[model samples]
Target: MIYADKTDLIYSLASTRARIFLARPRRFGKSLLVSTLQSLFSDGLKYFSGLQIEKLWSDRQYDVVRLDFSGLKIFENLEQFERDFKSVLLEAFSPLGFNINKSRENIVFFDQFKSWLLTLPPDSLVLLIDECDTPLTSHLDDDEAFDVIRNHLVKFYTVLKSAERCLRFFFMTGITKFSNTSIFSALNNLTDISLDTKYSQLLGLTEQEISLHFEDYLASAEKVLRLDRNQLQNALRENYDGFCFDRKAQNHIYCPWSVLNFLNNPEEGFLNYWYASGGQPKVLLNYLKKHKLANPFAFDEPRQIRLSELTAAREYKDIGIEALLAQAGYLTIRSVCSNGYAELGYPNKEVELSRAQLYTEELLRGKNLDPMGVPMLSELIETGSLEEIVARFNAGINLIDYQTFPITTEAASRACIQLFLMGAALMPEVEKHTVLGRSDLEVRAGKRHWVFEFKYAAKTKDAAQLLEAGREQMRSRRYGVGPGAGELHRAVLVFCGETRRFERWLEIEDAAD
Candidate 1:
């Protein structure tokens, strides 16, 4: 694996804060960062070798205690839980020349470890904790067990807090953040750099890192992809980039896991590497599945949230759906305002499309619609006639139980169409942003791309009249003129209130101004 130099940041962050916490989506390289920091602290200078941090870091080594909480299983009883973490402790303590007493309870071993740290000089130990929140995620439905597990974790962390004076550097990482009211209150003075601008690119790969460190991978991909240098970069950006975490929305990064996978197999072109990884927090997915219909356009549009919502970590059940989605990596900071409002939406084409297919499937299961219809939609888009496409769209639209899920707005209607098109392998991006304006839906099928404008006619208008209005909207605004905009056809779809279906659908034949 080609490593990008991020030790400069590690130098600044480690030197400034004694206890730091980083919150990121799974597989975003939190464990890897902890591993690098572990090596730097345990073995000091020689470990970093040629890395940039080698010169910046002081020539100092400490007794490093690295603990990954993901390995701890939550059993039904406190005795079982204590016995479970005992194994993790014994192995981690072996290198330090101490056989931790396995007979003692979980908190006792930690307390004993704290006592041993006191034997050394003050601030002489380094602690690295990874996936610290994994233990409590599985007990969401079991509050008693959740509290038992949480209280036990608080005890373990309290040992670290008591031994703060003996710790030179303490770093922790997890996907979900617990607040002051819960496990966070156990450890005072813990600085959360989850949304800190300076460290937003700390875990994810930056544009500079991708261009500098992975040039050979991109070149190989370019040759196999039959695309020039610029095209390859654009494709990578479209597929796996544009995740912003800071308030300013300044640093856009590529998913570290996705980037590495693409670089390793660039000839495979781009895929939904992140979402397809199947590493989503299961508890979060269950939450979304239940509340998905609350706002169908949540991911399609730029959703706004207060700055405080993101900085403070809440219990899973309390965090608003939008903030939950943002923290889960389904949404990212698109922009921010002066008064502490951050607008968030899908980070890139890959996430947007993957979510579309997911939502469409969920809808099908809820409505008891034929799942086969989705594959048929894909086949029609690739080889069928225009009339066949229209029929398929109408059927998908009608599949929604109008009585249960009322469609009162244009957004609702467009969301419905977008889901179906996305199921058909069309990859429809709703309200796609461009310099000119937002195209209602931009989609691609077998190398044929289109810019679609949707119209809602509540009153008297013939199909031709409604379609002309849509065509005018596309032409006057030039809705499709940006990256990957080579040779696109204009399209219009109209829904009449009287018919409650696609009253008109046509692809206009217009080339020049």
Candidate 2:
């Protein structure tokens, strides 16, 4: 269903002479855009009813060469996958009267494609390739296999650069863009419009489009959600909005899948439809597990990166963690920072909670600890006493193998504690700075303000001394002295390295600056 009339931009794009490439997260309507283009080029204009492009584009039909690489089987080795893939490519041209196949020995695939294109008229073929990077990403785990497939990919993509004169309009879409990959090297003329301001709204749904398309649905959903029109829109923004892709950051987009699903089943009530549908994406999951989730706090804090980091072409092998998260839709531009930088954070509550759950699970499971205990902390806070909370928390930590997963420093230990707090929805801020000194963690509850100071002891007997030190650190530095100091409560957490859990949990009575 065409919710938004993006045909203007789509027409502007397809009417161009450049070979275009777009990178968007999986299920973000890339396939839909490809199908729309396929229709436009193949003279399927009847499907464009009431669309601006319906009257704009010429009715002349072209010989379209549309190749979908998403479903190719990742066979045992590069040799088998490439052989089958080559056969698929050649077979695609069979309908166009070119029956060339790999069975014709000694003729390479790209050469066969080049020879076939030479037989065609100039600017005669509209080539649209979808999921173009799947070949590279599918074999990322096997470095040797990845290199092999990447090498073959160079030959595969050369067909584009080779057939440039015979191509009418070219567009390819994928999830990730590789900088040092053979595609860019072989086909150097690709216009990467992924961050171009003009096409920023090309892939996702904008706010105005939602209202224009789903106003009636919104009116009915308002009653089901128990929210007024404004409240419902605000709620929707908090749950599914905040995706910004352009360098200028003029527009914020909503995940189309999440919004459509919410309208169909408003009773589900703004759940994390996109992330929850499949859990964490395969790329992110593999990255976190490969690193043993050493620095899970990376997901906890807002990250700042140069605009170049988001826009510049980088090899997949050398792409930054922040870039991966952004590319996979876990992170979105929060604000445009000075000095050509962008601050990135979880796009919405759904994404934030989903990340916390994923990272916490991987972090704890790596330590042989159970993840269920973390979320239980939120429930414990609502009902259980402080002592009771510690007891329950310790029960989970007892399963940790201290020898295998040692927490010898305050940082290592605090990171674990922060992960647990985040998983519990506490949203703990690490090293929250004040005029005097910094506190270990500052948590903002609605009415109550919390400052936590953590102290690590080498042995259990020294825990009490460190406990007092933590309290002194908080009091003298006035870690809890803020606008809500009246409702402020401080805690000193003393942990013993041997036990690998907080041995002392003290609640401070002092409210001082």
Candidate 3:
């Protein structure tokens, strides 16, 4: 098949011979990109009479060696994993006619391979390694096994650092960057292009790229979804639209597999392409069980954690939640603080909603349905009627078993308000470094915006007073700035308690003079 436009990454490879480290989330076409590069430089282009790389290298071809550790049982157990890996390498090079003249005994196979790579056609040799972090992550449960595998990988990669003259270019890819000097210390010269903006769309498909590639699919999609082209675009955007390689880039990209699958099966809303990459559910379940963390509905401020701290390889089964989540593609480091701290969170709406649904079901298993009080609140907010919301709140509180965890009346009220706000209100979606301050809920629908201040109280009068206070807080905080200046919308307060609480919901439109 003809390769799509990944001219940026290919251009990088062609422009320089430096060792490259490309870290992209899995199924972002890392393997395909590597394969394209291999075909370009290697002798596998016998059929490439008119491909992109053929246009550039019509006269140039070189010896290529590809190593895919992805299929290796690197996570199974350390000794067996290494032994199997030694065999895979021997088999990989044996077909390439490299001299395996030394005793076939199970010695340091990497050492033998290094000696052979040096004797190759100098700059004509390119080495590509894929899924290099598999070993480290797989053996994390077994420290001794992990250490042994880590040393082997380190020794192997470090050889590339010294064999500068023997290599034309070296490309390595993984879902996560290995911590400290475990394996990455081996290749000190490798430039990490994971966060480089130049090749942001190199592996993933941008909206423009998708539209251009599957123009035929769009017409079919529009017809099937009963949406016009623009509406179809908007629907696709809402579901799988938030991902961009550049933080500021507007070229929202969708997962290639998901898009294609949607094209193939137009009836599906959103398929689990993120999980389809494999092994995420197991990792998430493991982390959740270990941490005992809940509250997946609301967003939490990012936390700072060190790579060395994660690699300590002790306690909590030697796996850090942040590290595993980052690597498994569930969460991403949104920004790096000036103090060298990393802020991490869900990358997009697709991930956020799916994660919430999964975590909520897991944690709230066997919990009463009254815990989720948003449906009733939505009715009250949409119709400006408080009767239903009040009834639901009281019903939940009156029937509270409260045996699992000590629940304070105030805390329950706040949680009830949170559940309502989270589901009923449409929050201003923030991305990357844009800090969203704490507020009950910020809702925007069409031209109307609502800032809610919820106050749950035991008495109706106190609830009303608390509601007024919350409105004042909104005004004092300058909740919405700039564009909607003087366009202040409504501030609402909601109170729920044993004694009928008096709460007021005020409609504040853009105060036009």
Candidate 4:
């Protein structure tokens, strides 16, 4: 079910400034929204009959030029990209009855396009450019090619500013927001509504929209899953919802792509549909590697950023990772602070699990560890075999080559355990704070509660002392004393001189125990 009904967007589109730029993560329906606008501007109201927009929209026809820059392969060099770019533009405009002289230069094409625009009636043309950042994103690794594409886009967009009088409306959609000094420098009139509260729900599915559109699916899923309607809805929300564009807006939106995929095959359980389709962007991976980001699994704290920070170019290394992740749709606003800061985190389980898998692969690269070993850690936890989990962790740690500075062997070891448990959907909580102190890791498997405390010992003889200290800390902090803390398994993990050991001292027996 397509739960997005953004007919109200038409009101904003008509009343706002003519130049508009909207950026959203891929598969969040940017292209679909563009198609809707195309139909609306073309006076195809019949397509939207019985929808909210049908009553609010005015029937008017305009000369619409819709250009989709997606699916164009990035060429090896600037010369090749320019050739392909010109060809793509020509192909897009050819259907509009524009016969133009062939030009490889973007400026030349824009000039020709402007001249053609003059031939049409004033204020009768609508321009929609979809996936406008594909050229830059596809060539992110090549500085020369990226710059060439950015310059070309800047030149082309300048024409929009210059031909303002000839256009009735201009809308551009893309995944990333390039800085003003880049493609949008000349198109100063373009207003970014990506974070505007009025349009936050324009592309994604709001909860009400999901209920309205997928009522039948929800009812059927309740019966099939043997759950009540509310239970089914909550499960769906936990798995596919939690995307908050406007922190002040009470309604959280669901990723339309994941929701639809779940509805298509509810019996298959919740899969990483959107993440599996696109995975992590190569550019994002490259940046994380370059920056040596140690922890990629969590972003719970709210990061403070100015609106300008959001649009700032990626060239600035100081730009926070939180901003990039949020813009890329991996992280989203969880809450808004009074100080104007937007707290961000993974939108849902689909994102968290997929990111955990990606991070695990990144962490274990070239370690000679079996790829299947990660899942085995989860299996050991589920089976409540403490010995096997420790043995598996020690083996994995031994394979990893340790470094002295940032991200040492110990840190990597802890991160590996956390990520493996998370990948298995075990709900591992790291650095959990309690009244006494913070626990290293706390996880649940069935009725068993496992609390781990990690310690490092420089000498082999100190391993026992460190392990005992970890146990004492766990006991003093009462890490395993909460409700349903059934069958608490408290363990201390010690690392010393290329050796690892696990010692369990306390076990609060469950009723069965």
Candidate 5:
């Protein structure tokens, strides 16, 4: 099937400087963009026949060199990485009648390649590098190996800087932006267009594009799912849309891979195709584990980051979790402020649900509780069993490793509950404010609203009073007046030392005052 047309990107590239570096989340069409560039530079208009680029693009040819680092096998050590790096270079150049000696080091090979470019027609070389961060990202768990890979990449990319005069165009794409000093310090002339508003839609499928390209599929899906066109479109958007790269970009860019995969099997129903395509990046997981972030999936609200700070790579300690999550594709820009800050949040339901599951699994690991118990919790909530829900929560808390028990803050507890409920596809809102005050956690299953107030006391003797205080606050705040407001199942949970229990349960019917 025909995919979203990104030939307009070619026009933008042609008018810009030669060297460009783009960073995006995995499965967001980086490699496809690289291939398109290669085809544009080599086969010219023939490959782009009826596409937008065919009308705008000038007829020109360049000797293109495409290097895909993703194709290389996982390296056992630095030696293997370096050897394979050189081999890949040799293979990429060999097709062009340029023989790169396998024994030569990468630096030497670069020098040879640069000298060879001079013998060819002037302005003939167009270098397209894909998955440029594969080696470095693969070794993030090992600091020493990671540095070694970065050093190799530094040497390999330094060639592009020195040979810029012989190149007509150059582009490299990767999932994450390694610190400039760490990898691309030598290539200072390379323009980073990853966040540029003009190119934001260059890689992903915009809502308009989705409608234009998938009209037939949408019709078919609507008929099969027994929904109207608008409902079907909204369903698709909720599941796979809302990825925004540039702060000024108005169009919500849906993940190309997810969109295509759904079209390929519309009958299978909605699924987390993109998330399931690959394991969570070890680097991101390590960061989350290190920070011990309580609410990894959703922020209480959108987070703001300056445009300059958005892509500026810093040490993990200096980098905010929101920024890391945004770059990692688990979160996306929700809005941009006039002061040059962008508010970020989970891009869509697919990301929100997938991350909730992953985070819940991590929280439950080693605690001997079923991570899948999240569904049971939702079931209990749906049935309006406040006692069972509280019982299950207490039991789960008791099973947590003793050393990790006795969480210090109520916010953490609320985050855990939100994550659990979200994992089961239940809507959870933390610190949800009502007419009077904010509730600790509010979970919604269908039309039922479960309001929870947590009380932490240093002694068991204070638990009962604290729980009463919680219930009083919920009652005074009138926390059950929002949309889908039904029978309010309110519970007060008190924690003391290593023990947690529900002190009170109150069910207020919707018909009651």
Candidate 6:
């Protein structure tokens, strides 16, 4: 039944005397966490008998102002964004018989709301602002109006931060941390507990939690899919296990909505749960296209960020990579860096796949090709077969637009080969950015080092010959210019042309292969 996340909620709420700004992606159960806190603060101890909150304090009620703005979807242009945002204050406090009018904007509304909260007895003003970042995220591109909204938010939150004695506790949750000339600049006192291990399992569903809570659904899934529990677990894990808030606690979790989708539609697999929540990849994709940021990929933890740069409005392009992933629910802060560079990466396998898909979707510019290629390519990588991998690369060739510029068939073929190699480099590998012998991309996985080369054909020429020449070049390349020289595991050449693609995979299976 009731999970034990309430402990973290109580602690976070109680620990912060000033304003608190917590950011997590959609479907991470933020609303549920806040609601649980609301109940606890409302002195509903009967609802949480064994929760950690009960042990921390005696049952006491507080005058709470819970502004759950998640339900307000009215966001398109500037006027509506402002209008609806201000309207929420009225709706939230309307129960207090406050006849707030339309002329009162978000800033004024919030000021009045705070004043109302302060009027309550001392230590009675606990303000919870849910989906606080939605309004900002909704108008990411609209710089002019977004500035107003940001100012409104900043001034509103600054009150809570400034008036330490007037406010009991302030908590805000939202998807994606809005950086740059945003409200965070104003609420500088707001502590970001986004990575704290004490609240790591605060959002999302761990595998153990799912199996324990939804055993019936798992059984039903097994019966419908005709799969054993292990297979089902593997499938679920593959789709959703990579997100970890606590690096030591490997089973951090998946969004509860995604799990429910799998249980309800076992045949469809994990169908776009990450995209379903507010579905706004435009900002990320737009930036990617505008500036081709072909980063080999970044996965680590405690991603470093300059607080000043992050809250600047003009530096959207400079947003920290890890912060993006964290806001999008792809990464979590495994550790905090009081000083020095912050390391950030996917928490687990589930987040890895989700991030991969999200990145791929953005790269392809809204193309939704059947990811049958993903599993196929995954198989090729698993087998470590060069030929199979080449074929798969060719299979997905048409999916990529190779005609970025006009060139001879030979040049195109060469580009295609190299392009596929570039794509393959996105796989999990070490020294992931290095090009071996100035030829193929050299990557190390575990103890195995792989050298990959790609060659293509030109129109009006023999495609097969081009491939052979490409293979010869690869041999001449004689890579393994790294630490793992003698310990090389495989060398692969993938050649492509008009007819199809071929691969020449060689592993150190024997001394005379």
lDDT of 6 by residue, 1-513 (tens): 436344745665675565676666667778887787677676657676766766666646776779976554455666776677667766665765555545766645666666655665666567788987665655565668668777767766665655556566778887656556456776666777665557666777877778877888889888888899999898887666656555233336676767777777877655566655643354454445555553322322235544332223345556655456555665554444556334455655445545555544543445543254355444455454555565565555545544432223433434443333334333433323435446435544445456554444433255446456655655554445455444464444433333444433343333122
Better of 5 and 6 by lDDT: 5
Better of 2 and 4 by TM-score: 4
For each candidate, what TM-score against the reference? 0.85, 0.83, 0.68, 0.86, 0.86, 0.67
Per-residue alpha-carbon lDDT of candidate 1 for residues 124-220, written as tens digits (9 for 90 to 100): 7788989887777666666676677787677677766776787788898887775632657777688988888898888888878888988887888
What digit string (tens of lDDT, one per residue) describes model 5 on residues 428-512?
A: 7778777778888877776677778777676667776877677677666777665567756776677665455434444444323
Q: Which stretches of candidate 1 lie over 4 Å from their true place?
A: 73-82, 94-121, 289-293, 366-375, 398-404, 423-425, 429-439, 450-453, 457-513
Question: Candidate 4 residues 329-425, lDDT tens each?
Answer: 7777777767766666788878877777666566556443335535456667767466677777666555443441123344544666777666556
Name the lDDT value of residue 176 in candidate 4. Answer: 76
lDDT of 3 by residue, 1-513 (tens): 324576545855755878888876666778887887787777645755554655555436777779988776434556677778777777666766665565764655666677777776668777788877665655444567767776777777766666668788789887665454345556666777665567666776677877777887788877777879888787666656554444323333566655666777777755555654552544356456656454432334465555333223233354566766655556655655556455567666556555544543443453443446455444454454345545654544344333432233543444444443433332333211213455555555445454555566665657667766766665655565446533345455465454433245554343331
Which runs of model 6 end up more than 4 angstroms from their true locations? Answer: 1-12, 15-18, 49-56, 71-77, 97-118, 162-164, 179-182, 247-251, 264-272, 276-317, 331-513
Candidate 3 shows a clash count of 7
Candidate 6 accuracy as TM-score: 0.67
RMSD of 3: 7.4
Lowest lDDT block of 10, candidate 5: 504-513
C-alpha lDDT values of all predictions: 0.75, 0.76, 0.58, 0.70, 0.73, 0.57
Each model's backbone clash number: 0, 0, 7, 1, 0, 23
Better of 3 and 4 by lDDT: 4
- Candidate 6, residue 237: the lDDT equals 78
lDDT tens readout by residue for model 2, 389-429: 56756665565555556668777667666666666656667
Lowest lDDT 10-residue stretch of candidate 4: 504-513
Q: Which residue pairs come into collision in candidate 5?
A: none
